[model samples]
Structure formats: structure tokens, C-alpha cells
Target chain A: MITEGRAWKFGDNIDTDVIIPARYLVTTDTKELGKHCMEGVDAGFSKKVRPGDMIVTGENFGCGSSREHAPMAIKGAGIACVVAESFARIFFRNALNMGLAIFEVPGISGGIQDGDRVSVKHDTGEIIDHTNGRRFFAAPLPPFMQEIIKAGGLMPHVLRKIRG
Target chain B: MGQTITEKILAAHAGRDVVVPGEIINVRIDIALANDITAPIAIELLEAANIPSVFDREKIVLVPDHYVPNKDSRSAEQVQIMRRFARKHDIRYFFELGEMGIEHALLPEQGLVLPGDVVIGADSHTCTYGALGAFATGVGSTDIAAAMITGETWFKVPESIKFTYKGKPQKWVTGKDLILYTIGDIGVAGARYKAMEFDGEAIEALPMADRMTMANMAIEAGAKSGIIAPDQVTVDYVSRRAKRAFELYVSDSDAAYVDSKSYDVSEIEPQVAFPYLPENTRPVSGAGTVPIDQVVIGSCTNGRIDDLRLAARVLKGQTIDRNVRLIVIPATPTVYRQAMAEGLLETFLAAGGIVSPPTCGPCLGGFMGVLGPGERAVATTNRNFVGRMGHPTSEVYLTNPAVAAASAVLGRIGSPEEL
Candidate 1:
């Protein structure tokens, strides 16, 4: 089963730099790191985020450097998942490897808004946005990836598989 | 049913007669790489695996470029670890700063990589080798660890796009402009999970440097890799550098491509990427006025000898605006020595630009060129996203070295046409 969240809208090509600035890369503590999420692009982002918020946006949503810190900071900041029109290749892998929830919703950007509570069923491509009680369709996660998410990131997933 | 250069190579490396798109296959690597910024962590992971030695010591090439000349102890310590690792494992090409340059530049220049081979590097720009008709990609440290231990890794074959070019470039337009134009048309994610193959008479006529500039920036378009089939230019370059002769690969005329685009370069002009992303681009003529505090000219992209020579030609006898501080770093020490011997250093210093050692500094906001809050600078480095070069609010305008040099002279974003 997949967890659901309220929507948090962002614009096109919301790069990794806007998600997490490089200054905070010195530490690996996710909690202390979440405080600075989106601080680079929007200083008010931290206070504005509520638990269970999901980010929705346009293409190349993580288009800059290959720093895994970008996804780590986002997942750490209580973002349930990021459903983008598309994602940069490195960011896509990094997000999955880190076990942060993300989906590719090719045509759903025009159908969503901020503060809209949405329940995403990853296996069925079902999306329930509570604001207008609308249902939107998206690509379902691949079975292999779903298993990885179930185990919570690549490391744990690898450990579980290897040990089993 | 046609095979791409990447597909053909991966199939050959995997010992298969043929491999198709979306099919997974395990292929042996011709080369595995890691630089200073990525090597230490990858080496740490490899050590944890408790392997006695790598699958083959000579197959690994360790180059220290990003933090070369060792600005701080932490970076210096990382270099020391890599050196010890290389020495202990008998790694053949462990290039130090003075002996090394950019890994991408050094790899081909030293003839360590060849066509139709599978190569992996811990750094993303490793895809730069795709220009030589190889199947190359970047992976994480753990993946590199696996490759080190087993000498092979699995990949799902990618579809490819064919980019056909026609027409001669106009005055003052360089390869950087053409690539920026291509990225603009494709946006940032147009080529995800696909390879891009450059073809036709136009791509054929381009110098090797131009082809490399195109392949180097292919990642900015979200492509897994971009390549041009090896032609006379490629063969000559490889032959001159490699002690042993190597074969080249080409895509079939009827090869399948998910998409294709064509360009005529006669209308091209100098290009610049605005304050945030590589895709945030505009022609220099369309790039309107913006003030700046700093200027930079070095990175894996646009940090070669040709880049410096282009800047030097524009700033030969001129002085930069008194307010702007310009920083110029050669891509490799060899490039530095060449620039010095050619007196490019004298021209740069005379024009008020400060020269730093070869490192990927300022490109990642790691060291040397950190931006102050609200201060904007025109740079020749890749990526202008917030905080990419330092403070988030400090804007960066990405341009070729020529435009960067001109902007440094004018104290704001301007064109090299004036110079």
C-alpha cells in the first residue's frame, strides 16, 4: 500500500538547487537538513510545509548536479512524494535509490493545485485529489521499484534481498 | 531494427551477437573511473566489500582534478587516500594534478578509451566519452564498487535520437552556441533514457573539440549519452594518442531513432545561460543588460585549452572593468602549461583576470569562487541554478569563455562582439 498526502504546487523545472542549497551538504543528519529545504528558492518554504505534503510540477524537476542531498533533503522535510511531469535522469535514480517516494505523472500537472489532499495508489495509477473530489490517472510504479520502496530505499532493499 | 552506436557497443561488450532496446545485458567494462570528489567515497565502499584487489588493476583510471593542487586538508587527504589505493592496487593511470587534467580530456587524450567499449565512471560527466563512440554512463559509488569487484555491470538498452546538422557556422559562433541552441529546442528532459547520435555532413566537418563540446553537454538535455561515430578526425586523434591501434564503430544508415532534429548553423550566434539553469539560455544579442560582481572561466565544460585561447583572443590588450573580478582556471595542468607557453597567461593577467589552478572549483560552490549574497557574476561554468556557484541569491550567468571575458571587461553581462 502507498501513503497519500495533500498537494504542494511548484512551477516548471524546479531544480535541485531550489530544493536544497549546497551550503548544507556538510552534514548527513536529515532532520537538521530538512530545516533548509527549498530555502534557496523560497525562504518561507519550511514554515509553509505541513506534514504529508506532496510536490507537483513540470519537467526536469531535479535538473542540476548529481547530489543525492537534494532528494534526501526533500524526503527529510516531510514531503510524502514528488509527482512531476518529468525528472532529470540522475535525480530519478537518486530519488529511488534513496527510497524517497516519487512518481512520473506525465499529464497530471494541469489538473492539480496546492493544499489539495490526494491519495495515490501506486499500483493502480489511481489518484484521488480531495479538493474537488477528482480522480486523475498516472503511470503505475514498476513492480521492481515498488518492492524497493517497500523495503525503504536501495540499501535496505539490497540488504533484504541479499540476506533472504 | 537498426542498432545505435551505443547498442552495438554494449552488445559487443556483452559477448552477444546483438542486443535490442529495453533488453538487459551484462557487459564487461573497458575502463572504470573516479575522480577526487567521487573516488574517496567509492574507494571507501570498495574497501568495505573487503576485496583483495580489483578485477583488474590496469583497467581503472584514477584522476584527481576537481580539488587538484589541494586547496584544503580534507580534499588533500582524499587525494592521498586515492593515491594509496592506486599504488596498493597497481592502478596504471593514477594522474596527479600536474600530470593530469580533466578526466574526460585525459581519458581520450591518453588513448585509454576506445570505440565500442563499455565504460563507467563515478562522476556524471563520464558520459563525455560517448563522443568517441563508446557506451559510457555514470553511476553511484556502490555501482562502481560492484563493477570493480566483478568487472561488469548490467544495463537496459536505450533508444536513440539522431541529430542531423547542415550549413556552416557564421562569424563569432562557436560549438557552445550550437549546443545551447539544441538544448533550448529539447528543453531539459526531452532526451531522458535515450542516446543522441550526431550525424550528417555538418557533424562530420566539425573539429574534434566541437564534437566533444556537444557530447559533454548532452547530459544537460537529460540523455543517457550522446555520440558521433568515429570519423577521420576521431581516428587520427586516437591513433596519435594510443600506442596500440583500436577499431571504431558507426551506426547503421537505417538505424532506428526515437526522434531526430536538424539545425543550420549559419544563423547561430554566441549564447548565454541566464541566472538559474543551463537550459535558461539566450543568444548573446538577445541577452539584455545585467550587472555582475564576479566572473569565472573553468569547469569540465568550457575549461579546455581552446576555451582559454578563445578568451585570450578577445582580451589580448584590453583591461577588465575596474569593478568586476574575473577568475580563470585551466581545465588541466597540461592546458595551463600550454596557455603559459603560448603567453595566454600574460594576456589574461594583463587584462586583470586572476588565474587559479586546475580544479572543478567554483563550479560546485566547493571552493575558490564562492559567491557573496546578492552578488551576480557571469561565468563560463555549467549550471547556474541557485547556489550552484555559491550563495543561492547570488545569480550566475553562464556563457562561453569569450563572453565571460568580455563581461568581465564591461562589468556586466555583455557580448564579445564589442571586443
Candidate 2:
């Protein structure tokens, strides 16, 4: 699978609170969550983000809270994927479980500027910086996770198992 | 190759002889826990998946702690889903308002989580159970949804880091301070994706509440779990409450570790983590007297009975500073009742502090005591991140219950010795 999009960069320690604050946690609806996405960090994130636009960020992309609302907000805002130097483990699991594309590319943040074009190949862990014409590698995804994401996240994966 | 306690627990659950770090394993969990905030989404996922029923109703536990007492209609609706789902599923452990406490505190108090158990929750601080020597960690709601059906989930076994705490703690120091000092030594992400195994003279000497406090903030250090090998203290604490049989897995002396550190507990003072991150810590004596608007002494991290008693000892016979509005919240109804029975609530009330019901309350800035713009608070709760306790411009200073109580008396971030 290939994801191509412009990059919206964030800095380090971008916590779940800023991605979507607790005050908004009363509702878990993705679209409603998207409408206020990153309002704590960037007041205009929801309005500015476009479908297929990737969020490229520095280390610890989703630190703090286990609220899946953070990633749901990003996916709901129509972002194609998130590429980071690293990710907080829970957020990494949450994104994949929800079928959101995420790439852990070491030093990927240094290569892509905000709004630069980027492409990611999920099959091979290859990331092509279309804007800068540079290519980088991401840590390979485990095959089991690949299966879950292929089935549109863990829900369908479980359904397949339970119904089997 | 010898395996750490975490590895051993995972290996036993996965039916493997031994497991190494960074390998993936799917283990059958003993306890699958969730709260109102995460469980609603999980229930929705299970309903969406059309999985007729859960794998083992007895293994699944639900608690409505966040926004519980249902702050508003929307929050009430979210909890209503858990209430209905539990009824339909015949879930054995559904803790409503009176029976509820913060999930982390409640589970331990009731002996629902025990040593050698593989526990997962949809909430981040699920790692708190690690203090009981359980292989526990936080997961996303979808994981909970799937685990509800299969009683299993996957993990990329984390490398282990051992921290050795030596020397006796200072008079005012507690588990919160030790964890804070450790977080300061290791930056927020320093131990990311690893198990923090704590031990040594000081840790072994601490009480179950303190051990739970240290393990609770393992998440703040970005650790997968914070654990202490169970001993007599752990055994004595659980024996009274735990009705189920349990195992106590200890780390092999030869177990390999990725990193290790030794701290002299006596050298560490009651610490305070300044605003924006729990890693930015300083000794309370050197905290420079930053005036505060409120003092909150509660939350899963420090809302246990021990924490309340420490705070009450400081607040007794002392009037609250006119400038500070102190809010004391016991983590669970049990702690609340214990504190009430012991007259700790009276001490707080006499000191001009208000006692709230056992809800997370303003710990997440969710009500009870939300800060106004530019207001600053001294809190015993974990995480002093931006807007954590209220308005964006408002600030939070994290410390133990003692320092929190003393700060309320001094009307600033100060030490108990100052009183």
C-alpha cells in the first residue's frame, strides 16, 4: 500500500491531550473528534488538514493518555498517515488497531518540511520524499499487524477469528 | 538465558518455556480492565464487530471512573453504554458510583489484580498493577474490544531496565517523590518501550501504596510497565483482599537487562515537577516559592489512605492559606470511608479545604476545580502537562501529598519543614 500526501509537521512531545483534550473526550465519534483535532496544539489544525496529507513529527508522536481519540481525530481529519522519528507504544498500537497508517522512520522529521510531498510504501517500509527526492527506510511492520491492518483494524480481525 | 519477571510472566501466560525481549507474544490475560472513557469505544467496537458475546464474562471488569457521577448528559450517555453492556454480558465486576473508585486504585484494593497476572486496560495507568508483580500494561480500546472476545492480545516484549533504590528516604519523601526523582533522572522518553524493574533496600522497605505509586507513573516515563518483585510486604497486603490463587514471579539474579541505575533515596528530597512535563523536577526546597491558586491532594497516584493521612497530619490544626483553595479527593470510596472514619476529612474541612467524592475530578481538569486563566495549582496527581489541570495558561506543580499539603499551608510551592 502506498500513501502520498503533503506533510503537516509537529514537534516533540505532542501529547494526546493537545491532539484532543479531555474536555472533548465525552464523545468518541471520530468526525466530531476530528472537528476539534489538535485544537490544543494548533487552533486551526482541523480546518487546515486535508485528506491524504500526512502528519510528520519528531519523537514521541502520541505521548500521554491512552485515549484512542487522538489518532481517531487525525484519521477523522482525513490525514492519510503519520510518519515520526518514534511513537509512544500505546499510540502506535491504537493507530494500527484503528487501521491508520503510521511509519517509524528514524530521522524522517529532518528530511520533510511542513507541506513537502511524501510517499510511503507499507509493504517494504520505503518512504520516498517526493519534495526533496530522498528515500528512507522504516522499521518493518510485523506480519501479524499487517494482517490486522489489511482487514481494516482489529475489530474485523477479531470478528474473523470469533466467527471462524 | 535467564528471563526477567516480566518475561517470565509473559512466557508463562503464552505457554512458552522462556521469552526474550523484543519478540512478539500473544498471552491469555487474567484480567481485562476498562473504564468509562475507554470502555464505551470498546463496547461500540464489539457491537460493530457483531461478536455475539464475550469470551469470559468473569474475566472482564468495567469501572466508570472518568466523568463518572456523569458530569453532563454526554458523559452520562457514554457510561450508560458500559452499564448496559455489563448487564447484557453479565460481566461479574461492574463498579458503579458507590462501588467505584479510580480503576487503578479500586482493582488493587479489592484484590481484583494480583501478582503474576497478565492484565491489560484501556487506560494508560493500567501499569499500576505492575506493583503487584503482574505483567500489566496499558492498551488501546480496540485491544480491549478484541481481548473481550478472545481473552488474549499481543505484545512486543519490551527490554527491561532495572533501577536500584538504596538508603533510607528523607522524612517527607514518599513513593511519588521516588518515582518523580527517577523520572527526572531518566527523561520522559528515556525508558520508552521498556520494563522498569525497581528494587533495592528502599523499595523493598516501602509500603504497598508507595510501591503502587512508583509503578503508577511508569507510564509518565514512557515505560511499558514498572514492576517490583513481590515479597512479604506484597504477600501480606494481598492476602487480606485477594480471594483468588496467585503466583509470585521473581527476576532471576542472572536476568539480563538493557540498562540499570542506582539511586540513593536519602539524597533525594521531596521533589516537585514543574509545569509542562513530569520530567522537569526540582527539590521542593529549591522550588523558589511559586505562589499557587489551588492545592489538590488526590488521584490514583496519591489518593490512597496513606496519602490522605500524610496530608491530614500536615493540615491538622492549621488553617488553609486564604489565597489557596485546597481540594482533597480520596481515590476510591473505600479510601474515602477510611479517611472519614479516621477523621481525616474533618482535618481537611477544618483547614478550610473541601473534600470531593472519589472522582478523578479536576485531576484531568474535568470539573470540581478547573482552573481559571493564569491560575496555578500544586497537585499530587501525576502529569503536570500543559492544560492538564485547567485553562491552557494555568500551571500545575506535581509533588507528593506532603508537599502538596505544605504548599497549601505556605500558599506556595514549599516544603513541610517551612511550616
Candidate 3:
């Protein structure tokens, strides 16, 4: 699973309230949530973000609230993946459960600027900044987590397990 | 190797003699909880998976406290979904509006959780049960669905951070102040993916309500859980309300920790978190006269009977500023009844405050007391993220009940000493 995209950068502590505010939480429809994604922080985010764009952020991205809407919205918006310096624990798990690929690369945000073309090799955990010809490595996901993501999130993974 | 309290609890649940940090393991769950907001989504996922039945209906607890009284057709529909799922699964602990409180506060009071149990909830503040010496944490709706199907979930044993407090608290300084100070000291992500073990003489001496307040906000620091060893105080608190036997586990004296910090409580002052970030804290004396339009005192953080008594003591005879609107909500119906019986509700009403039912209404901007553009509020609820209460332009200051009451009277940030 390799992903190639341009980067959209944000700062630290980008909370769930800013990702998709509680006002839009009336429904669990991922597409509707994607329409309002990042509107709290950047009003034009939904309109401007293109499919296959990657989000890069400073430390502690996705903090506050255990709502899966934040990651679900990001995934539904056609964003390929999120690379952060760190993540709030629940957000990290939620992203995995929703099959939204996320990677933790310390100092990764400092090296890449917004709109920089980048490619990620999920299997090898290699991040390549095409704009600058620089490469960074993130720890590979564990075998079981990789399988869960491949199965398209937890529900599918569990269903497959039960069927087997 | 000596095991930390968190390791001990997780190992016990995993049916292992020992476990270490950073190792992924599957553990049996004792209690699984979901509120109105998360339960609907979990139920949807469960139906999508085509699972015939829940692993154990008796172990699941559902509560609809987020947008209770049917704020809108959508929220009402959400609650209906949870109700249908509860009935379909024969869930034993389904709580309706009248019987419900905030899940965090209600679970321990009803004795559904016990010491050394592994608890999980779809809401982030589920870590609040760690106050009872349980290995509790929060997960997402899909994870909750998986747990509903299998009665077990996976976890990575987290590294532990030890916080030791000494001496005694000063007047008007409470658990709220201590937690604010700790979050300020360690930035919002300081304890990411780690277990926070709170110890020291001052912490143990704190009452159960205050300890609950401290443990409730551990998620604010990005901690997986916050815990205190069960002592005589825990035993006394649990024996009165608990229905069944429970196991108690303590950390070995030689247990290892990733990091440690200590503070003297006597030297600490009342604290507050500024707008948009729980980590942006300042001593109350230096908080200045930041005017406020509203003051809220409720939520799982500090919405107990004792928290109400503290606010009532500050607002006994004085009225709030005409420009200010004070909203005081008890966490549960039982807490509401106790406050009314103790005259706390009457005191709030007499002081120009509005007392509402036991709902999480204003805390998460669901309804009841949402702020308008450019309005500012001082609240006792956890999390002060931008637009948490209402408009993106509106601001919230996080503090304790006493400070919220005093600020309501002054129409600005102030302390009980000013009264």
C-alpha cells in the first residue's frame, strides 16, 4: 500500500473540535462529516483539499474528544494518509480502526512544507519528499495492525475472522 | 521484575502473571460502556458486521446523557437507535433519561465497576473509572463494536509516569487546581500513550470526589489512564456502594517508571486554563480581570454534590452580575436530589443562577447554554478547545466551581477570596 500525494501542514494540538465540531455530529455519515472537515480551523479546507492529499502536522495531532468523526471525515475526504510528530492515543487507535493510515515520524513535519509532493511506502515505512529529494523513515506498523488495515478497518477484520 | 500498578491490572485481565510496557496483548473486558453520542455509531457498526448477538449483554452499559430531552430530531433518532439495540440485545444496564447520569460519575456510584477491573468506554473520559483502581481507557465506536462482538479488545501496555504530591492543599485550592497545574507543567501531549500513576500523601488524603476530579482529566494530558492504589479510603467508598466482591492490586515498591515528578501542594495556588487549550494554565492570582458572559458548573469533571456545595458557599447571599448568566447542572439525578435536599439548588436559584437537570448539555455545546459570537465563559467542565461551547469566536476558561461562582458574581475571572 503505497500512497503518493501533496502535503497539507497544520500545527500542534489540532483538536477534534476543530476537525469536525460537535454541531456537525448529528449524523454518523462520513461524507457529510467530510464536507465540514477542518472548517473550524480553515474554512476553505473542504473546498480546497484534493483527493490523495496527505496531512502533515506537528506534535499531538488529533487531541481532545474520542470521536472517530475526525478521522472518518479525513478518510472520507479522499485524503490518502496523515503523518504527524505524535498523536493522542485514542485518535491513533481510532484512525487505525477506521482504516485511515497514519504514521508517526518525529521531526517529519519540520522537514516538509505545505504543498510539497511526497510519497509514502507503507510497507517499508519510507517517506520521500519529492520536492526536496529527501527521505525519512517511520516505524512499520505491526503485522496484526497491517492486516487489520488491509482488511479495511476493524469491523471487516472481525467479520472476516468470524467467517473463517 | 517488579510490575507497576497498571501492568499488574492489565496482566490480571490478560490472564498473565506478568506484562511489560509496549507489548500488545488481548485482555478480557469487565465492563463496556457507551453514551448516546457513541452508542448509535457502535450499534451501526455492529449491525453492519452482521453479528447475531452481543458477546455478553450483561456486561454492556448504555446511557443517553449527551443530548437528553431530545434536543433535536437527529439526536432523538440517535437515542432511539440505542434504545432499540438495548432491547434487541437484552442489555441489563440500559439507562433512560430519568435513570441516567453522566456515564463517568454514574458507573462507579452504581457499583458496576470495581477495583482491578478492565473497563472501556466509547467516550474519552472513561478513564475516570481509574479513580477506582481499575485499568480503564477509552476507545472508538468501531473498537467498541468489536468488543461487543468478542467481549475482548487489544491494548499495548503503556509506560507509566509517576506524579508525587506532598504537604496539604491551601484554602479554596482543590483537585481542579492540582490537575490544571500538572497539565500546565506537562504540555497537552506530555503523557501521550502512558499511564499516569498519582501518588503521595496529599493525593491519598483527598476525598473520593476530589480524586475523581483529578483522574477524570488525565485524558487531557493524553494519558491512556490515571490511577491511584486502593487504600482504606477506596475500600470504605466501595464497600458501601459495591454489590459484588472486587480485587485490589498495588504497585510493587521497586516498580520502574518512565518518568517521575513531585510537587508540594502547600506551595501551589489555584489555577485556570485559558481559552482553546487545557495546557495554557495560570495561577488564579495572576489571571487578571478577563470578563465573562457565562459561568457553567457541570460535567463529569467537577459536577458532584460536593462541587455544588463549594459553589453554593461562594454564592450564598450575593447575586451574579446582571451581565452574567450562571448555569449550574448536577451530574446525575441522585446528585440533583442531594443538592436540593441540602438546599444547594435553592441557594443557586436565589443567587440568580439557573439549575438544570442532569445532562451533559452545555459542556459539549449540545444545547441548554451555548454561547454566542464573541461571548466568553468560565466553566468547571473539562476541555476548553475552541468552539467547545458554541461559536468558533466564543471562548471558554476552565476552572473550579468556586472560581466559576466568584467569576459569575464579578462578571470576570476572580477567586473565592474576593467574596
Best by lDDT: 2
Model 1 lDDT tens row, B347-408: 99999988998777787777788898999988876678778788877888888788888999
Which runs of model 2 end up more than 4 angstroms from their true locations? Answer: none
lDDT (10s digit) by residue, model 3, range B1-419: 79998999999889999998999999999999998888888999888767799999889999998999779999999999999999988999999988899888899888898899899999999989888888899998988999999899999999999999999999989989999999999989989999999999999998888888998999999999999899988888898888777999999999999999999999888898998899999989999989999999999999998899999999999999999999999998899999999999999999999998888888888899999999999999998898999999999999999999999999899998987
Worst 10 residues of 2 chain B by lDDT: B44-53
The global C-alpha lDDT for each of the candidates, from Candidate 1 onward, is 0.78, 0.91, 0.91
TM-score of each: 0.89, 0.98, 0.98
Error of 3 at A105 (Å): 1.2
Kindly report which residue stretches of model 3 are placed more than 4 angstroms away from their true locations once superposed.
Answer: none
A67-119 per-residue lDDT for model 1 (tens digits): 56677688778887888888887778778767677788877787888777888
Candidate 1, residue B94: lDDT = 96
Clashing pairs in 2: none
Q: Highest DockQ among the candidates is held by which one?
A: 3
Worst window of 10 by summed lDDT in candidate 1 chain B: B138-147
Model 1 regions more than 4 Å off: A4-6, A26-35, A44-53, A120-127, A135-138, A142-164, B47-52, B68-90, B243-245
Docking quality (DockQ) for each candidate: 0.34, 0.83, 0.84
TM-score of chain A of each: 0.88, 0.94, 0.94
Candidate 1 vs candidate 2: the TM-score winner is 2
